[model samples]
Target chain A: MIRLVPRSDTPALLQVATPVMAVLATMIAGGILFAIMGYDPVAAIKTIFWDPLFGLAASYSRPQLLVKAAPLILIASGLAVGFRAGIWNIGAEGQYIIGAITGAAVALAAYPAPEMWIFPAMVIAGAAGGWAWGMIPALLRNWFGASEILVSLMLVYVAQRIAAWMAFGPMRNPEGFGMPGSRNLQQYPAASNPELIAGTGAHWGVVAAAAAVLATWFLMSRHIRGFHIRAAGTAPRAARFAGVRPETLVAFCLGLSGALAGMAGLFEVAGPAGQITDKVGVGYGFTAIIVAFLGRLHPVGILLAGLLLALTYIGGELAQLTMNLPAATVQVFQGMLLFFLLGFDLLTRYRIARRVTA
Target chain B: MIDPIALFLLLLSASTPILFAALGELVVERAGVLNLGVEGMMIMGALSGFATAHYSGNAFLGFAAAALAGALVALPFAILTQFLMSNQVASGLALTLFGLGLAALFGKPVEGVKAPTMAAGPLGLNWIVWLGLAMVPAIWWFLNRSRAGLILRGVGENHDAAHALGYDVRQVRLAAIAFGGAMAGVGGAFISIATVLQWTEGMTAGAGWIALAIVVFSNWTAPGVLAGAWLFGGVTVLQLRLQAAGVRVPVQLLSMAPYLATIIVLVAISARQKFSRRAGGAAPGSLGQDFHALR
Candidate 1:
């Protein structure tokens, strides 16, 4: 019988190695899945993992990696903080939507204004909108014994509905013939989140994502509040005794994550998405949760994980075009990667033994 | 105007999916495991049941397949949390993503195909609906009066003590997870087979989540779950009725009622627990805590 013994100490290197192993395992398992689906597994795998960067369409896909990774990394950076503090805010998708709406409201209201301050103002509104939405769960949890996980998750549906309402009722483009979407921000130069350089796909959101990683790294590893968060997660009672306020930590974590997610949403609407629609959320908020976990909840790790996941998005699209694979194949691949990563995390916590021995 | 009895039957049909799911989740939570993959399992069940029923032209067989698929899909979560000691929350979320993606992938071929009509049971209600109603009393009886149920409760309440008393915590939790998955699956199948009558991507929507909220609202009781399901079902039915009547109320806002209601209920119950003396009264002792028998 197989038995597991708890390790006295988990090696840092082993933790890093585990994700790589999980990736390899997912490739093998995903290949099997593809084979069963009657596709050339090797070609499918190559298309997904290698083709985005090396395939014939690499030129277009390379820039897209940044465009996709930006939101995921930005959102995950904030989520990692909350996760570290034992707070769960699973409604980033909702926050992102609300943020986009609020951020775009500023631009839409200032229709013909060529003022340089409009975009900055929109950014503020976006962050504020996200903060307000995130604060709902934080306040409820602080006031009551409510589960933030359920509360936050419920809000996602609520947010989706709100996005739908806005798209159909208020934000419907007047110029378009009864289309259920906002005015295209892409066409509005002042409002648009344009690329900073020629073809690199580097927008303000991408820059902000890189900044979030650095800020989070410093906060978690340097700041005393970060120490409090770590302490609260590991030993709640001890952290309380040491004067760390649970409510404050809860608010800080939720608000920070919410704000970051909102910014991500704002950038998306102004850049790649270009308009608010019923389908605005697009699962980026949900996928970022996987990114956080995949990154081992570390800032640097999250950067790499974001890029890897972005690769899947681009590669999944490429696969759809080149190999005629179902779009869900990428989703399945993402899900499988997370499953394997979580399963293999067992190795870091315990040692497997063939026969029992003290 | 909608007839009173007709409205009641509509409510019953509407509530059945969530009822099945909430009841299954109740058993799981009572057994001290929090499996958040109800949404995933239900979607899997929906797809599998719809596909099976579509192919075989037998709706009954579709429900059966859903139950089986749900159980099979839940095994990996059980192993990860029960044996591997992974975080239950993360694993459960991953399970949902996996199920949704897999279902969407496989559901492509079955999309737009209408389900064969299932033979109606007594009183013109679907058999699955009646079965869902019957499960209420049955689960209450099992949880309150049965010997195996009591042992399962003990394992959930105190795994270490239960292990000392020679009970297997892992086995009990595993069984509970599978049952939960199966129930959720059937509930999901009800949507595709009986209600929607066709397969659609992400059609289960947030029914699984609403089910989770109901488990909390039920205080982990079967009859309580029934009441919560009816309340949600009633809201949904009324909302649909209002829509049909061509009221000026925005459909999107109307549809958001159930989710907002869930949030309100969760907040109210949690506040009561926080302010009342009976803190941690209804929740199982070992809920969300992984159990490992030390050597």
Candidate 2:
């Protein structure tokens, strides 16, 4: 029998190699899954992993990579901050919805206006909306000792309902013959989150995603608060003894993550998604959780992980269009990636040893 | 006017899935493991059950398939967390993500397919509903009276002490997690085969999370889970009634009932747990911590 011997320190080489190993394992596993579904496994794997970036449709799909990656990177970066402090804000989806609603509300209320301040003001509203939504769990945990995980998750359903209400009722486009969506923000230039350089998918959201990656990297590595956050997650009692207030940490982590997720929503609404529809949330928030883990909860790692996941999204779409694969295959593939990552992560903290038979 | 009996029946049906899932979670928690992938497992069950029922023309077989699927999905989680000593919370989340994805993938072929009709067992309720009701006392006995149950609880209360006492802590928790997965799967299958009578992506729709909250609301007791499930079911039934009655409130707001009710219930139960510290049964001592059997 083999026994796992706990390592005194996490192996640095394994720390880096595990994510890479997880991806390779997922590829092999995912390939087998495709083969079981009767598709040519190699072609399907190539379609999902290669075609999006370098296939015949690379020109079209490459740009979408950034568009898809933006929300993921933004949300994962925010979530990573909280994850570092052992604060789980799983309701970024809710925050994303509320942020889109609030931000779009600003644009709709100031419709067809040529004001410069409208977009910036909408951004603030979006962030604030998300921040407030995140506070529900934080405050509940702080005041009543509720589990943030359940509270935040429960809030996602409520946010979805609220988003539906907004689209079906209050934000319904009047000029579109009773359609259940807001006016396309893309048409509204002052509020649009358009690509700075056409065909590159380099919109304000992408820029913000980059900014988030940098800022989080700086925060985690260089700041005292970052030190506190890391300390709290690793050693809660010690953190408390060192004067790190648990409530404040929870509130801050949740709030920051909420704000980032909300901004991602706002950007998507104004850019690629182009409207506040009932279906505006398409699981970016949940996917971001996978991105955070895939990246090993590191900011730079998250950037690469987000891009990798985005490749799967673009490739998944291509696979659906070309091979008649179901759209859900992408979601399944991502789920496998996270599962493999967690499984492989075991190697970092422990070594398998052969038990000596007496 | 809506008949009270119809409303009660609807409440029972609506609550059945959550009740089943929560009961399973109650056992898992009682054995000191917190599995958050109830939603994922439930969805896997929903998909597999529907697909099986559609192909075999047998609902019972579908449910059995679902239970097996759920347990199979959860096996990875048990292996990763219990044996490999991975983070329980992260592993559980991965299980959920994987389950949802795998379910959707499996459910693709069954989309738009109609489920076989299920006959009522007693009191105009389905057999699963009755099973859910029966599970309360059955589980209560298993946890409170049975010797194996005591060993499970001992493992949960303190693994180190349990280890000293010669109990297989990893094996006990693995059994509990697998049972939880099977229960969650059955609860999920209940949604597809009975309640919705159709296969749809994400049909479980946060029922798993609500069940998680219910487990906590029950303070990890079988009876508490039943009451919590009923309360949620009542809210779900009332919300649908309000929609049918065309009350002035928006349908979206009405749809928020169960989720809002969950939060409220969580807060209330947490406060109660805080106030009555000596009452015990708050949470398992090692609920989310990964256990490693060191030599």
- TM-scores of the candidates are 0.99, 0.98
The candidate that wins on lDDT is 1
Question: Which 10-residue window of candidate 1 chain A scores lowest in summed lDDT?
Answer: A349-358
Global CA lDDT of candidate 2, please? 0.91
Docking class of 2: high
DockQ of the candidate models in sequence? 0.85, 0.85
Q: List RMSD in Å for every model shown.
A: 1.1, 1.3
Writing each residue's lDDT as its tens digit, candidate 2 over B1-295 gives 8899888999999999999899999999989898989999999999988899989999989999988988888998898888777777788888888898888887767889899877779787889889889999999999999999999998888988899889999989889989999999999999999989999888898999999999999988888898999999999999998999889999988999999999999998887776775654468787787777675
Q: Residue pairs in steric clash, candidate 1?
A: none
DockQ of 1: 0.85
Model 2 bad stretches (over 4 Å): B279-281
CAPRI quality level assigned to candidate 1 from its DockQ score: high
Q: How well is each residue in A147-237 modelled by candidate 1, as lDDT tens digits?
A: 9989999999999999999999998888879989999998888888999997899999999999999999999999999999999998999
